[model samples]
Target: MEISNMDPPTRAGAVETTPLLEGDGKRSVQAVDVVPMKFRDMPVAAESIRKAFEDDPLMEYFDAADTAPFPVSRRKLIDMVDWMGAMHQERMLTVEGGMSLMKYGPPGNQTNLPSVAFLRDSLGRLRPEECAKRWKEFGAKARELVSAAFGEKVADMMEIQVLATDPDAQGRGYASALVKYVLRQGDADGRDVWLLTTSAYGFYEHFGFVTVRSGKVGEDNPAWDGEPITLRIMHRTARASLAQASSEPKSPVMYTV
Candidate 1:
């Protein structure tokens, strides 16, 4: 997760901060605040996502052709997030000052076609030719793989796209808060939620999402340009089971800064 709020200083003269979450044997971390991504938050959210995905295999592959001074271009990331954030809006975009997320409503709730023009325009202007080419080429295949893995019925679910908490905010419950917020929404609506992750498979397992498939990008896939990349498709079924599990205490509500 990307950074939001830093851990309260333990040094002398530090002010007190509220402890975030407590329950049965769960890992304890200070809590960071969260809120729906607003238009004003676009720039910060974009940068947060860029940093969050910097070490991600797929993301690194996408940026392999970037000539920017930094490993990733902040401008391209901002444009990309702007396009996506416009589509997901309040339902699936949440943020802490430095942490942010981009998720989606259940499949068929909205058509992504309208957003293509924005992506194309943004990528054309901001991304290198190779990077943009790889993005478009891989997008369709990724969706196909997800559909094939889950089948149509269950594939029609909410998806968590980008979850980033700033490094300084690591160990805080920000990531968990963003995830649980979406899961709770899905559970309340009785709709399944889905996500794809590379190395963080174990983290989501804590939230009850089960892995349905895991595989490497094929040699022919545009994203496989000499880099080894793998992804896991996971699903958390609707709230029926979650509600049953509700006898357990809940994680605390993450505040908005």
Candidate 2:
């Protein structure tokens, strides 16, 4: 779906804003507007996504100090997110407190290897070979699970690549707005929406996504401690409207990971 021209529902020619409240049960700040992300918004949007996932399990695995050569710093992750926004700006939507990047069609070559190699060269300490190997392994595993769960229909779906709300903005509904905006586009285009998430399973459930497969990653790394992070693949079939989907009960068809 082409979402560049699509605007979230708004009021009075201005993007609708959600109110920010204080700890004392009173309004503290003005509502922030949700809009399509612009080139100028890239840095802020990237930072927001990075901050939102700073403590995420998957990120922690990649950032582990003992994971020699493959470990990535926060700065590198931020740069990667910034690059992603640059590559797919048309599908990136942002508000002051949040951002979401969605992609339509098959999950083909989503990243430019040459660009990433350039980035690795520029960033000197980023061990390109090891990082590439780790990413390749992870990608292959993820694709294997997804293909097993969805079969050939995986190519027809829309993907929620990244959805994040700044930590302070958690209760303000920015994430929900971002998610719903993409979901509306998916529904309009007759595409099911799917995503891989290490957390927020319950959060997405409210929007009609149900966990179709679940598996542990990072278990192969001997340097990793504790239980391997569990990744869940969530899917939401196309529906006429978000309201209609929420009003009806759903029984998800599950696939073992």
Candidate 3:
């Protein structure tokens, strides 16, 4: 069977920020605010992605070339999230912000923590090179679609973060819509979405991504430089999935509230 597009639905024009109240009924750290990452948030997103990289000794290479010990680049940060959202329908939002402490501030040493700060690795992983390669492959189309959709300097690359909905919103398919949205963006841009993960391979595979052996990836990638870790890669064509999504009856919506 040929695969098709599974673009998610986007309800709002931009990220919305809400306030998270504490048990004492005071404002929490995240302030219950939600916003799709903007140009201004690039720095904060970069810092956030870096801290996430720091938590994983295994993922350190994601920060830079094997020779470089620090971050690969700030662009890598935006690219990571952009691609992540694109690949995951910007689904990383629920866990995006809270990752800082786990990534940077302290080693499991947080003060006045909010519930949003889940685990550090919540957004998942990516090597800078992989991000760039996919972006280059998908850039031209992405520039056209994303530019038209958002009206800005949408790079051949992108970054994304999406929040799952609440129980009150259960069965509404928010998560599914977000997933579809990213896939649609990829389709419009003519790029295949790529991502790495320790688990949840099944979820993505259903979308038509085949699991690639980590060995195959390591050997294929020079960045592994002959020392790739135990990792798995999954990817699907952005355009095809969107085509499929549009042609078929939508799947049953699954909510996370």
Ranking by TM-score: 2, 1, 3
Q: TM-score of every model?
A: 0.70, 0.72, 0.31
List, residue by residue over 1-257, the lDDT tens digit for candidate 3. Answer: 00111121111111111223357943333322333433444454445444433433234333334332233563344334443333232233322333221110011121112222122123222324564442232323223333333243222323232222332332333333444555666677675554333233444444454443332123345554544433333445455555574454323222110
**Clash count for each candidate, listed in order shown:** 6, 0, 36
Model 1 spans > 4 angstroms off? 1-25, 29-33, 68-88, 110-116, 119-122, 218-227, 241-257
- Higher-lDDT candidate of 2 and 3: 2
lDDT of 1 by residue, 20-93 (tens): 34576554655446676666666665666555655666666666765545534554454454445444544445
As a TM-score, model 3 comes out at 0.31
Give the per-residue Cα lDDT of candidate 2 at 114.
55
Model 3's alpha-carbon lDDT is 0.34
> Of the pair 1 and 2, which is ahead by lDDT?
2
lDDT of 1 at 97: 49
TM-score of candidate 2 relative to the true fold: 0.72
Question: Which regions in candidate 3 have their CA more than 4 angstroms from the true location?
Answer: 1-37, 61-178, 186-192, 195-203, 216-228, 237-257
Model 2 over residues 223-244: C-alpha lDDT tens digits?
Answer: 5575687767789999998779
Query: Model 3, residue 145: what's the lDDT?
Result: 36
Give model 2 RMSD, 1 decimal.
8.3
Provide the lowest-lDDT 10-residue window in model 1: 7-16
